[model samples]
Target chain A: MQGRTRNIYLIPYMLWIVLFVVAPIALIMYYSMFNIDGAWSLENYRRFFTPVYLSMTLRSFWYAILITGFALLIAYPTAYLLTKTEHKQLWLMLIILPSWINLLLKVYAFIGILGFYGPINSFLRIIGIGSRQILFTGFSFIFVAVYIFIPYMILPVFNALEELNPSLVDAARDLGASPWATFRRVIFPLTVSGVKAGCRAVFIPALSLFMITRLIAGNRVITLGTAIEQHFLVTQDWGMGSTIAVFLIIAMGLTMIMTENGKLVK
Target chain B: MKKVMQMFITVVIAALGLMYLTFVLNSQQGYSGGNTLTVYNWGDYIDPELITKFQQETGIKIIYQTFDSNEAMLTKIAQGGTSFDVAIPSDYAISKMKEQGLLIPLDHCKIPNLKYIDPRFLDLPFDENNEYSAPYFWGTLGIIYNPEILEGMEFTSWNDLWDERLRNEILLYDSAREVIGMGLNSLHYSLNDTDIDHLMEAKRKLDALSPNIKAIVGDEVKMLLANEEAAIGVVWSGDASEIIGANDKLDYVIPDEGTNIWFDNIVIPAGAKNVEGAHLFINFMLDPENAAQNTEYVGYSTPNMKALEYLPEEITGDVRFYPGSDITDKFELYENLGKKMTAYYNELFLEFKMHRK
Candidate 1:
């Protein structure tokens, strides 16, 4: 009877996975086999392997790496520092509050904040640095992406840090290990799962961001996501779009495997 | 074993139930011989009051939907799911739809207000004899610049955009055809030139002007230009008028090398369920007073010549928005480049953008 009840409970979740996840991926793979005119062909796959697409894939990977690296660099320290604070939970909530606002609204705000006449420019002029074009640059793109993703990065690391037992650090210190040595050897290893989790959370989405590239990067940057959008919407080439998406899914699976906790921990 | 069999039967029954529910809901939303008209148009393209007035005058419920791009609109209608009664697509899109047999022929007898439209807009190459579409609004691509920021500099032709003084001061519209067309026009070639060598030359010409180019953007070009963030912006004549309206210091001009004159027309999809209601809506919009009101609110050039009497002189008399034949005679409409060529243009444009970084 218990087994039957468990089976009944699993049915809805299995249905959701089949309907939303598995089915769509299968459709994309099926579509990827066709050419623009709906003829069965390998043209899309051949086109994807060309230099133009290869470079874009490389560029997209590079951007995703930079964004993930920056998010981790900022978030790890912030999360670590928050654990040492008195109102840690409140501070974490405050950090997460901005994310609750609509993403497009936040991006638009950055456009103004980074504009020629924005506060940052005014400050620069006051300090004799003078105004410069801050928006639409690669620097601005990475900056805005990291800012948006920092909360996701921080949450996972924060939870990992909170779950950590203090006696482990004390045991290291008690054994004559220096603070740096203790962290490198003890605390970090235990929290490696959280760091992997944060990276996974940030990197995959960064690979496929389209709107930020359009509004913040000024079309100067084209990620795999933007190319997919262009092909699917502007050119109405579903086959090519699906081909890019198939590669993206494969890349994501590889990222997950690389970040898997059990394998890395062992 | 009996328990496992029972579980499998339950799962199959649940799946069937879900599928049946979906089918029922979909059918409910499908066209069912109602006095309802589904209008799919660009967002904020029509005045809200006009829709209300139309609904009141005809007693037919209006189900208005908006799409941001022509391709998106075409995809939805082509999918053959929802039956959109009326759609407003641009010139090239109309041609593409007609070729695909996705549009229905317009019944002239039902749309008497078509007589009020300027004769020049009729019998166009895209919809010869107004078979599949009717002119709604038309505009030219031009330059909008802040005179103060430009100082004594002037943009008389497309070549002026490349002047060294405008370094990082020009905002190019983030559209493939229009920007590439500017390059072609500057080189005295047709905007629709499909020759590979000419296109390569145009791309090369555009590459040299990259230093002067600021951010290539979309609708935000209006806000950026109005705020004087850039000295010059290449935009549609309607957008130029809106920018000028926001900042009187700004001025608009049509480059002497000629430019693309585009049109948006009301077209009924082939799968329309309320074809008569769609005709009624189109005719109501084309009426002189209604068209004038729409033009004043939407700030695009009205194709209804008779509507000029109802419009303010400031709007109708402005040659920038309503240029004479002397200027318009040189303008060209974008031809429906086939799928391969269209994709090629997009690829070249993408290469040009990637070249910027």
Candidate 2:
């Protein structure tokens, strides 16, 4: 009876996934297999593997990894602090505030913070420091991606920390393990699933990030999302667009599978 | 009392769910009608008062929407979910829409001020005789540079895009065609080059110039130039005006390679429900006074010659808007590159973007 009730409770969520996520992804697959110009062809796939696009795919991958790595480094400390904080709710709200703003607005706001005449430069002038050319480089893109995704990393990790067996840490200390060893041996393994989940959340979006990078990095940076967007909109070639999209989906799929398997191992 | 509170909670939850359902369904379905005339155009492209004036005149409310790029505007139309009565698309997009049967051709007889448009803008590459599109505003793509930073430097050609002196001080527009087309024009090739070798040449030129480029900007190009984040940039004539308005030190120059002169026009979609209304709106906008108001607001050259008479001498006399006959005569209007060529151009653009240093 309890098993039947649990299945009943899942019905709405299952229907939602079917209608929204599953359907759109399935459509993408169907579209990817056919030529968008009212025919069937694999030319889109053939063209994708060329040196130019392959390099872009690799560049985008590394950029995303770097962004996710930075986000993890920043968020883990903050999430851990929040877990220990008395004002946990307030701190969480502060961490999540920027995520509530439109993504584009936050990016443009970065221009005011990082641009040539922005506050950073003006402050530098006051202190007789550096110049104003730091805002449009590839580094700026990664910074913006990490800023936007930090909360995504923080939330999962924070939840994992919140649910941790705190007494296990105490018992490890009682058995004479150092703080670092206790965390590595006890806390880290328990939180690995959340870290994996957080990494996926941050990395997937960061990998395909386009508008913010385009806006903030000033088009000096290119990612797979921008390439697909150009094919679909500028070229009006849905075949090529769908093909690039398929590759992005596949790359993301492999990453998710690896992360999930890692979580299972934990 | 407990039952009453539970009923109240149930009612509130149901209401919230209904609201979410409505929002989701509405996005899928599209804008519903209620005396609203949806006008979609480039961002900051027109005066709000013009919309108000039209609404007051026609008793039909205006639903104004703006897009940042020509491609974005086209995507919205192609989505086939939204119904916009009036859209202002650039010359090439006008051609593409007409070819795709996405537009309803205008009955020239209905638009009286159509005569006010200079004959030069009428029989253009995209829509000859203004059949499917009415010339709303026109301008060229060129460099807007700060004289203070440029010092004694003079930019006379598209080759100026590669001037090493301006390295890391220059900004380029993010639009693919504008960037690639300038490169093509510099090489004495058509902006719509389909030849692989010509494209390769454009690519090589862009790649070499990429290091000098600080950013590929869009709407923020004006702000960047004004703030001195960039000393020089490729910009539309209208944006050049906005930057110049902000600072007296800026000047827009039409490259000697013959900059692209384009007209963004008002057109009715083939899927339009109110063709007559759209025609009326176009006619209303084309009236000399209304056209002048829009021109003043957007800071672009109006196609209507009669409207030019009402515009301030500073606006009408600006060299960028009313260029010398030599430059004006040399301007190229972008025409639609049919399907295959468009795909080829897109691929080249993608390749350039991917290989960026």
Candidate 3:
């Protein structure tokens, strides 16, 4: 009777997954097989393997890596420091508050902050460095992305640190391990799951970022997401868009596998 | 276990009921009553008061929707999900829709105000004999510059934009067609040139002008130019008018080398449920006084020649926005470059953008 009730409870979740997740993915896969003309063909897949797409994929991966690397670098220390603070939860909330604001609003804010007559340029001008073209560059794109993603990176790592028992660190220190060695040998490995989760959270979304590439990068940077959007919306070629999406999905799966905790640690 | 089961069942019932309610509400929203007309247009293209006046005058409810791009509007209509009574799409998009049979033929007998429109706008290549579309507004893609900043430099031809003095002082519109068209026009090639070599040469030439290219941007092009962030911007004539109005120091010019002249037209989609209502709205908009009002508010060139009488002498007299046929004759309307060629142009443009970095 208990088993039957548990199965009954699972029904709604299964339905939700099938309808929203599984079905859409299946539809995309089905669409990927067809060409723009609606004929059944592997033309889109063939095109995906070309140098144009391959190079774009590489560029997108490179940008995603840069964004994730910067985000993790900033977030890890912030998260670690927060764990030592008296009002850590409040600080964490403060970090998350900016994210609650609409993403487009935040992006537009960066536009003003990075504009020629914006504060940064004015500061530079006063300091004798002179104003420079700061907005719509790779640097601005990565900066805004890192800023937007820092909170996501921090939350999981913060949670991991919070969940950590202090005695484990004390035990390591008592054994004559240096602070770096204790962290490297013990605390980090234990919290490795959180780091993986945080990276997964930031990296996956970073790969498919389109709007930032447009508004912040001024279309100078084209990620895989932008190409997918261009194909689907501008060209009205859903097949090509779906084919790229399929590859993105595969890439995401590979990332998950590579970041899987037991496999990486072991 | 029994209590938990009871609570779970109650929650499921409540969720199902909420979903059903939302579904019904959504379906009701799309329900076309006899007196309702749904209009899909570019954001802020029409004055709100005009829609209110239109609704009051005809006793017809108006459901107005706006799309940011022609492609986005086309995709929504092409999907056959929503039944928009009227849509305002640009020249090339009209051709694409006409070819796809997504557009409904306009009934001229109902829209008597069509007589007010200039004959020059009629019987064009996109919709010959005004079959599927009617001219709403038309403008040329041109250069808008701060003459104060540019000083002795005159931007007469497209080549002048490449002057070394203008380095990092030019903003190009972030549209593939206009930017590519500028390059093609400089070389005296057709903007609709299908030859891959000509298209490639255009990209190559544009690449060399990167020193002058400060940034490629969209609607914000107007804001940046008006604030003197850039000395010159390649923009639409209508946008130039708005920018020039914002900052009197700014001036607009249609290059002597020729440029793309685009038209935004109102057309009924194939799935329109209230066809008659759509006609009434189109006719109402085309009325000389209404067209003049829209022209004043939208800051776009009105195609209604009769409406010119109602407009201010300063507006109607401006040769930049309303040029004589001698200059307009050199302008080309963007034709529907077939799917493959359109994609090729987009790809080449993307490559040019990527090359900038």
DockQ of each: 0.39, 0.44, 0.41
Reported per model, the fraction of native interface contacts reproduced equals 0.47, 0.70, 0.38
RMSD of 2: 5.1
In candidate 3 the C-alpha lDDT for residue A222 amounts to: 84
Question: What does candidate 1 score on TM?
Answer: 0.91
Q: Quality of candidate 2's docking, in CAPRI categories? A: acceptable
Q: Model 3 clash pairs?
A: none
lDDT of 3 by residue, B5-29 (tens): 8998999999999999987875676
**Model 2 Cα displacement at A169 (Å)?**
2.9
lDDT of 2: 0.83
Q: Interface RMSD for candidate number 1?
A: 2.9
User: How does chain B score by TM in each prediction?
Assistant: 0.91, 0.85, 0.91
Residue runs of model 1 more than 4 Å from their true location after superposition: A1-5, A261-266, B1-35
Model 1 residue B128 distance off true place after TM-score fit, in angstroms: 0.8
TM-scores for every predicted model: 0.91, 0.88, 0.91
Pick by DockQ: 1 or 2, better one: 2
